[model samples]
Target: MFRVAVICLALSFSLLHAETDVEENDIDIEDESELRSKFEKFKVQYKKKYDQAEEEKRFQIFVENLKASKRMQEQDIGTAIYGITKFSDMSDEEFGAFYLNPVISNNNDPRPEEMLSADVAEQLTNVSLPSFVDWRKLGAVTRVKDQGLRCGSCWAFGSVANIESMWYIKTKKLRALSEQEILDCDFRSTGCHGGHPDNAFRAVIQLGGIMSEREYPYRGRNGHCAFKQSKAIAKIQTYRNIRPDEEEMKIWVAHSGPIVISMNATGLQGYRRGIIRPGAYACDNFRLNHVMLVVGYGTSRGYPYWIIKNSWGADWGEKGYFRIYRGEGACGINKLPITVVI
Candidate 1:
């Protein structure tokens, strides 16, 4: 229930822009320097409240982890806070919009329903494993480069990709499906890309199957849909929802399968390599601007990693993917499951 509320909260706030009309009115009396001062004050207050809550709830665990890691230090917290709150260029309204507006508007989206259906339960029973699966050990998995194709269906693609990866682990075969097949065929789908993974899952189940991208072909493109290839698609056995639990994720390689998640993409999305500095260092404290697949978890070099595959083209970020540290309690994306047509 609380989990559903969090998802709803994120979705609602995800819609705000930094330069909305309401922002102008909100900071009309303050200049840029004054705005920075106010923002700093607010950040200090926010950080204090955040730290206190975290420490009170999990001080022993957090401190123990810090002690064991050696890499952990008070400096880590200071650096993260400093990095997040260091900006000073915006006017008061813009600065306010950057932080406060999204949080305030987040209240508008109602909480999502928490009911679990009989069909969902049956599917879960049949498809889910008794054992925890470590995705990094899974052999020869494939990555899908979903063309968002001007649709907001990144969420759907993310969900499907994670499911597909799981399917590969269980079935030892790779199958690519056309997003269009699911889009046009699924009645639950909001047309022109305005849909979520739930709709995609229902659509696949409704069709009773989906096709391989090779047979139907993605075309890195969209076109008129044909129902002929539906037979090639597979039916899902069942699935699970693994919401991001920072602690569960600490040993996550042993606790879950592939995960679908979303985040704010750094605008420097197209460049494949080099250190990516998302100019203003925006979104360090924000959430849900982009969706992605968490295919595996491991330590890259010495840093813990969330092996993420993105929708951007192949030229972007380590073969259309990148790794972020699974530390400092950042990147807590919801991981849901989809079943392969078996």
Candidate 2:
């Protein structure tokens, strides 16, 4: 009797274990089904089409990216929201190749020897900086632009953005400048692969001036130089590199106009909206990768942030703009504060 009872007990234990396994498998299937639904919606929302094999591959990547986004959301110290974006389907390497310029992060190009004029320097020195400044609100900023895929021409876009703001502030006329002109003509740096804003500034000076977007439109690819000297509307004689201090940067932006800056864009991969205060470890101060325009600065929910204009289009990150924590030099923002002198 004892032997029969022991046999029955072992069989019951085995059946219970099998039942547990089946339940876990059901949960996994449900999870995968949900993910598939989300992926289908994502493709539809972004207008993405893929072959059968490529679709499977991209769905896997999207799953991994979603996991990473969740990790980012959990780890973020600020109010940043991380979720599906236009880049959700891409792997990190593919995303970096298409959007970011890693070369700019380690750029060691020689600075121009030109200095700010004495009068301009005196004016900047004496002008009292306001607690907040928004070039967009002041009508100095143009509409946010989109730099299409596989073209890492952020340097040109950033440089042109600052120039447009400076030109508007000086002339009271805002005109969209051509980034393709810089990509085509600026031989100092590689065109679409990557370039520096300083090189772009020098290119503008050498090319005499930059033409309006109407005359030389953006093609999102490299092309032969088609710049017409006669069509040039705005010009810059020189550019100034500000000291890597947030206070000085604010003063400069308040008195002059928007400034071009480069910073680590790793955190931006998962960024959707809200002021990004990712803390120091999440966004390294030394690993700069993407260049952008600093159009304004202000405080939000007791956190001071820098308003940055991005080249990723109007749909991404606060209408093609983002804000980062100001005082801590978050993501190496203060490392490369540069602006053209109009």
Top-TM-score candidate index: 2
lDDT per residue for candidate 1 within 231-294, as digits (tens), equals: 6655575544433453343333343456665554432222223222222333353444455666
Cα RMSD for candidate 2?
Answer: 15.6
By lDDT, the best candidate is: 2
Residue 247 lDDT, candidate 1, scale 0-100: 35
- lDDT for 227 in candidate 2 is 94
Measured by TM-score, how close is model 2 to the native structure?
A: 0.85
Tens-place lDDT per residue, model 2, 1-342, is 000000000000011111111111112223888788788867766678899999999999988888888777767777777777777788887776666645432335444445423344545556777888998999999998877746777888888999999999989999999999998999977777777787889999999999999899988778999999999999998998876678778878888889988888877876777788875487777767788899999987888889999887776667678888888888889877889989
C-alpha local distance difference test of each model: 0.43, 0.76
TM-score of each: 0.54, 0.85
Give the Å shift of residue 114 in candidate 2.
5.6
